[model samples]
Every structure is written in C-alpha cells, then in structure tokens.
Target: MKIGNVNINGKVALAPMAGVADRAFRELCVRFGAAYVVSEMVSSKGISYASEKTISLLTLSECEKPCAIQIFGNDPPVMAQAARFAVSQNPDIIDINMGCPAPKVNKSGGGAVLMREPKLCGEIVRAIKDAVDIPVTVKIRKGWDDNNINAVLIAKICEDNGADAITIHGRTREQMYRGTADLNIIKEVKNSISIPVIGNGDIKSPEDAKNMICKTGCDMVMVGRAALGNPFIFNEINEYLSYKKKLSAPTIEEKVDIMKQHVNSICKNKGERFGITQARRHIIMYVKGLSNAAKLRDEACKLESLEDFSKFCDNILNSI
Candidate 1:
C-alpha cells in the first residue's frame, strides 16, 4: 500500500498506541512482518518546547523504517512546528492524531475533541500538511458520540485539505475502546474519501483482518492491542492472506525467547531500571493465557532487575 510516494510494504500496519507501541515494540513488530508502524503519539506543545520525554518518543531505530510519527495538539502553528520537528527524525510519514479519547488530552483541546469541532480539525491538518514535505496523514475515530458520527465528513475534510491517507478506528470518543468497533462506519468513511483508508479496532486474528478489508474495502488494516503480546499476528495475517494456510502457533519456549529478546532490546535502549520497569506489562501480555500465566505475571511484576526478569522468563519456559 502506498501512502503518497512512500510504499508501505504490506497491507498490515501497527497502530500508534501510547505507552504500548514504544521503540522496542515497534521494531519488533517490523521484524515480525508489520508493513509499517506508527510511533506513540507525541505532544506538539511538548515537542515544540523540547521536552525530554517527548523528544525520546520520536526516537526511531534504523530497523523501523517506513515509520510514521504521530503528533497531537489543537493549535495550528504549534502542530505545524511539530511536523517540522518530526521530519527532522526522518520518519516516512507525519500523522496527526485526532482520534485519542483520553480526557487529559481532549480537555486540553486535542485528540477526539477535534472531532467535535470540524473546522478546527481542517485547519490543523492543512497547517501540518503545508509545513512538511513528507506524506501527511490523519488518524480519526467515528465521531464524538452516537448522535454525532461524522467520520465521513472528517475524512473528506482531511482528504480535501491535502492528507495523503486517513485511518478510521470505527468507534466514537464516548465508546473509549469498550464496545466492538463499527465496521459499517469504517466502510462509510472509505466510501466517502478518495485517499487510502486504513481500518482499525477490534481486529484480533487473521480472519478478522481479512473480514475488515473485504467488508470495508479499506486499503490497510492497523492492529493495536492484539499485537501487544503477539507481534507474530502480523506474520500470521500476512501468511493467511497470501496462502490461505494457518501458520503454527509459537510454542511456549518460543514465546519466552522472544520475550527475553524484547527485554534485552529495551534494556539496551533505555537501561535496566527503566526498561525492566516498563517491560512488566509486556511481560504479562507475552505470557497471557499460558499455563500458570496469572501466577507468573504476579511474580514478574515484582522483578527489580533484568537478571531477575530473565530468570523469571526462563522458569516459565522451562515449566511449560
């Protein structure tokens, strides 16, 4: 799938999930066969101010190319400046986040709040598109609520104002990831826009990915929570789509090995203390649904160092 001049190698992409799709995870997803990945959303104001943490979120490893850096803010000028800053990192695309539903973000005039104000959303996208040379895209939700589902209108606004592509998450701000994502809404957005539409939300398996694309006529599918513990879902979906054959599931031993590798990469990039601390959640996701998984997660969360974490993973693999 091509977003503007950039060719996203496959039809499956990783969603930019804050606190989840960090650098290590994104790189791992790419290695596992995700055609492209987006960085966790960065704050435009924070990036403009050169906040240390915000700058770190834009850090992309060489292996994770064709990556898009997503930024969120309401102010047009600051958002455009943030686009320039993201371009400096040499990302393949700059995505504007108008989909996030977190109260902290929306209350500040960013995220899904933009959905409530279409005029402001257009201005922001136009300004950011005008500021950057790279492909510009927008990630949006269905609308603000049941009474105001306006994804088609917002998508048209984005496409008409110079967005190279649009991603629809198929839920409203009020839903907040609760109910199943509305595929019908995604299809509506696809029908209403001329740019490529990437469908997102509630896709957990290869069959689900196929259904989303076949039903909606979307150009790409973005996986979020489903890929947390299972980056291999990308490879699985690709295999299924291409050959109509299901691949063997990863063995417990294989899962542990990948988990350890992910931990090692995180430690190398962020150091043991912070990396191990941050890895606890991923460790849980990695081991979820296996034998004694809950007990293992309890113990893993208490781990204080990489050595402890490594030993924990080894024990789980050996026991299984």
Candidate 2:
C-alpha cells in the first residue's frame, strides 16, 4: 500500500499512542515489521512556541522510514505552522489527531472535539495540506457521541480537503476505550472514502486483524495497545497475511531477550534513570501471562538502573 508517494510495504502499521509509542517503541515496532508508525501526538500550540519537548516528539530515525509525525490542535494557522515544523524532521507523512479522547486535549478544543465541527475539520486539513508538501492524513473517531455519529461525513470532508488517507477508530469520543470497537463504523468510513482507510480498535490478534480487513474491506489495519509488550505481533501478522501461516508464540526466553533489548534501547536514548522509569509499564506488559507474573511485575515497578534490569532478566531466564 502507498500513502501518497510513500511506499508502505506491509499491511499492519503501529498506531500513535500517547505516553506509550515514543521513539524507542516506534523503532522497535519498525524493526519487528510494522508497515509504518506514527509518533505520539505533539501539540500544535507547543510547536508554535518551539517548545523543546514538543519538537523532540517529531524526531524520526532512518530505520523507521515511512513514519509520520502526528500533531493535534484546533487552530488552522497553528496547525499549519506545526506541519512545517514536522516537515523539518523529514517524516513520510503528517498525521492530524482528530480522534484523541483525552479530557485535556478535548477541553482545550482539539482531538475528537473536532468531529463536532465539520467545516473546521476541512479548514484544518486544507491549511496543513497547503503548508506542507508531503502527504497529510487524519485519525478520527466515530463521532462525539452515539447520537451524533458522523464518521462518514468527517471522512468525506477530510478527503475533499486533501487528506491522503483516513484512519477511523470505530467508537465515539464518549465511549473512550470501553466496550467493543464497532467494525461497522469502520466499514462505513471505508465505503464512504476514496482514499485509503486504515481500521483500528479492538484488534488484538492476527485473526482479529484479518477479520477487520475482510469484514470492513479496509486497506490496512493499525495496532495500538495490543502492540505494547508484543511488538512481535507485527511479525506474526506479516507472516500470516503473506503466507496464511500461524507462527508459533515466542518462547519465554525470546520474550525476555526482546524485553531486554527494548529496555536497553530506552536507557541508551533517554538515560538509565528516566528510561527505566518510563519502561516500567512496558516491562510489566512483557511479563504478562508468565509464571510468577505478579511478583515479576512488582520488581519491574521498582527498576531504577540497567543493572537491576539485567538481574531481573537473569531471574526470568533462570526460572524457566
């Protein structure tokens, strides 16, 4: 699949998850076979002031080619400026965050709140399209609420305004992450749009991924929370999609190695203290379903140095 001139070689891409899908995780996903990845959402307002933290989120590495820098805000001019700043990082695409349900983002007039204003959505897309030369895309939800579902309308508006593709999460802002994702809404958006549509929400297994594509006829699927401790899902997905083979689950040792590699990368990039702090949740995830998982998670939460993590890995390996 292709997003504008960018060639996407696989069918499963990683979603832009805030506070989770940072540089270390994104690169790890790419290495494991995600088709493309989007950065955690950066604020257009933050970019306007050239905030160091916001600018850091736009950083891309060569290994994660075909990655996008996602930005969120309500103002057209500020969004356009943010797009320019993202372009400086040479990302393959610029993704607009129209689907975030965070109270902080929506209360500030961005995220899924934009779904209520179709005209403003169009203006935002058009402004960014005009500001940047690369392909622009939007990630949206079903609507603001059940009674106001209008993903099809917002998708059409985005397409008419020059969005290269549309990614639709199948629940309304009101639903947040609760309940099942409505695949029907994803189908509606796919049917309504001319550009590519990537289906998201509730895809936890390779079978779920296949079901979403077959049921919705979407061009691709995007994995979010499921990929947290399981970047291996991408490789499994690629193998299944390509050859109809169900790859065996990774062994305990393999999972430990990947976890260590991920931890090391984070520590290398962000320094051991901050990286280990950020890696706690991820470390817990990697040990999910394993024997003595509760105890392992408890130790994971207290990890402060790479030395602690190395000893932890040894314990995991020795326990098997």
Off by over 4 Å in 1: none
Q: Tens-digit lDDT track for model 2 on 208-311?
A: 99999999999999999999899999999988888989999999999999999999988887789989999998999999999899999999999989999999
User: What C-alpha lDDT does candidate 1 achieve relative to the native structure?
Assistant: 0.93
Clashes of 1: 0
How would you encode candidate 1's per-residue C-alpha lDDT over 227-294 as one tens digit per residue? Answer: 99899999999999899889999988888888889988888888899999888889989989887988
C-alpha TM-scores of all predictions? 0.99, 0.99
Task: RMSD for all candidates, in order, please.
Answer: 0.7, 0.7
Cα-based lDDT at residue 85, candidate 1:
92
Best by lDDT: 2
lDDT at position 80, candidate 2 = 98
TM-score of 1: 0.99
